[model samples]
Target: MDILLSAIFSSEEEEQYVLDCMAYLMLLMAAWTFFCLLSTNVPYGRYAMYGHGFPVNAKFAWCVQELPAFLVPVGLLVWTSAAKTSLLTNQLIIAMYLFHYAQRSLVYPLLIRGGKPTPFMSFALATLFCLYNGFMQIRYLSHYAQYPADWITRPCFITGSALWFLGLLVNLHSDHILRNLRKPGETGYKIPKGGMFEYVSGANFLGEITEWVGFAVASQSVHSAAFAVFTIVILRSRAVGHHKWYLAKFEDYPKTRKALIPFLY
Candidate 1:
């Protein structure tokens, strides 16, 4: 166990490591995301019928959409290390990954109650992916400690940090609102009315994307930028799908609202 942990955490550098690593990570994440979308049933659509008691199709969109979410970070870790960037970037990336995993793996599952059985195959594959990512991210961050002392005071950093905090607040609050809307043993869709929902259908996803985009800008790394771009691609697609679903389902749904963006799409 100790050896496995060490291997996951340790970083070995080669020339152009950062760029290469980021590229590979992005590719892997993109691939995995695509597979998830293709292989498993669409949770939202499936839940609408079995879990939420709404009628929806269970079609899998193109597999490409899945790749960006996971691959980007994986690629970033590899490329950043190879490029010999500062440990600060590595630490930040790792922290973000772990933080994200905690939410997706730990908190998300808990929020879900007894409903349609989540397919074991899908659950197993997703769990493995999350575990692998969690280890890699935490390991890299643990080894990374030093940062530019003035990073927090810099304008870019300040702005980025503010965006990150805002995103976090929106994501958390949006999730809270959704969870509260559904009572125990109740199965049906409920419009999230408060918080960022007033502006966008997938406000939670938008918040998460914004958070990472801020991180990338604050760190000023190509690796981070790549991750941000990939995130935007995947989440935007999901947001668009979600927006259409909302419009079709709710007659009183806000017509003026965008998909992922707040005011303008």
Candidate 2:
């Protein structure tokens, strides 16, 4: 019995050590990405610089790049021996992460009215990030996370949950406004109005940033915090890029709209 208990504790410790390492790596990645993005635009979407690689269909690229974020967690839940579902808090947190990816990977791509082709380099990078972050988050929650019985009732959890849902609504509504911006056969860009777009040029990016921040706050884990920081680093740059593009593209662009934040950038 003593030997068996020692083995079990050793395994648990090893898992935890791995989780810590991965989380730290993600933090390092966030720093590196921030510096890299300072001088260069993110190599996809509206600011795509296509010389690095071939272009892929935007819808297909979205599905392929984002699928691993949803699928990897499902795979971990099935294969891991940890008591992931035994804790209600774990279940809820995992559900929230999965829910976001399910919509992003499966539904959002189909809903895109006319997305531009993504560069192969950008698609590959995004695919790699999805795999890494998906594993980091789900592995921590399903195997390493624990919470008090009243965790769900706590102020932090409540506030984070509210923020998460609000961000999701904003994100979905912003996407809706963007998809409807141009007529079916239209090709050029148009000013996105309504929803949070009235306040920020990158409403969708703001929503996504809010989402991961909420996830970090609710989970209260280093792993989730790393992910949130990375999300903010990347998306904030994206929002700024979009704002600049809009300003340069159209003389009539809204002068009052900020980049990522509302009423302030």
Candidate 3:
């Protein structure tokens, strides 16, 4: 497969074709996200909540769907080309991505005490996203991207990694708050508190957007940038929905808090 393709096409030719695929995919994602923002609500978790479809266990769905993002890169390293040209910077970037997914797919799912069932449709969509992004990021960084030997020591890399780490902490903490909001045998909505929740209605989303932005800054590739842009657009819209939902659901919901930021939306 990869071996045959590598033999068939020159390095430059393959890189260009793969990049074009990534760009097209990103464009479609952007268009779909825009449509989602304008015409439709998010189809999962509390926004649309329950819907028509075969339901899957939420923990199972999270583990299985998100596993691709965690496993695909390792598969690439094992089954496909092993880093077209090894660079510490590229490895570091991939490591950061895998670190997040490892926790998300493995740790997060098992920690779920009780959660609403997910529609098969929503699970399928999330699975597709994981596969797409997993392949794109790992493929580009491991094979196509050409980072400098000293790139890791660069200011942008250092800053971006710091931001990414900070965002990861924020996201994990926010999610923990939400997960514990309900006690055993309780199935009800409660306001998420602690960490960045004081500032934003969607602190988890804010952290995710921040992480992706940092990825773009560090990688400095169209692949990473596209993902970042798409994440921000979609999550910001979701944040807006969450903010509105909280206000409507609870009269005492803070009026001072913004959707995804402290002072400004």
Ranking of candidates on TM-score, top first? 2, 3, 1
For each candidate in turn, the TM-score is 0.66, 0.95, 0.92
Candidate 3 residue-wise lDDT, 117-168, digit = tens: 7888888988998898888888778777887788988999998898888889
| Regions of candidate 3 where Cα sits further than 4 Å from its true position | 4-12, 49-52
Winning candidate number (TM-score): 2
Q: What's the CA error at residue 229 for candidate 3, in Å?
A: 1.4
Question: Once model 1 is optimally superposed onto the true structure by TM-score, how far is the C-alpha of residue 198 displaced, in angstroms?
Answer: 0.5
Q: Write the per-residue lDDT of candidate 2 for residues 160-194, one digit (tens) a residue.
A: 88888888889899999999999877888899999
Local distance difference test, each candidate:
0.59, 0.89, 0.84
Candidate 1 accuracy as TM-score: 0.66
Count backbone clashes in candidate 3. 0
Q: What is the lDDT of candidate 2?
A: 0.89
- List where candidate 2 sits over 4 angstroms from the true fold: 1-10
For 1-265, candidate 1 gives per-residue lDDT tens digits of 3344336546345323543474468657766666565433345433332442332221111111223334544555554432323455445545565466446544565664433444334444444544443333333343333357676678887787677778878888887887788777777888888989999999988888988788766766555565666567667767877888789999998998999988898
- After TM-score superposition, the amount by which residue 65's alpha carbon in candidate 3 deviates from its true location, in angstroms, is 1.2
**Where is the poorest 10-residue window by lDDT in model 2?**
1-10
Q: Candidate 2 has what TM-score?
A: 0.95
Deviation in Å, model 3, residue 157 alpha carbon: 0.9
Give, for candidate 3, the lowest lDDT window spanning 10 residues.
43-52
Residue 166's lDDT within candidate 1 is: 81
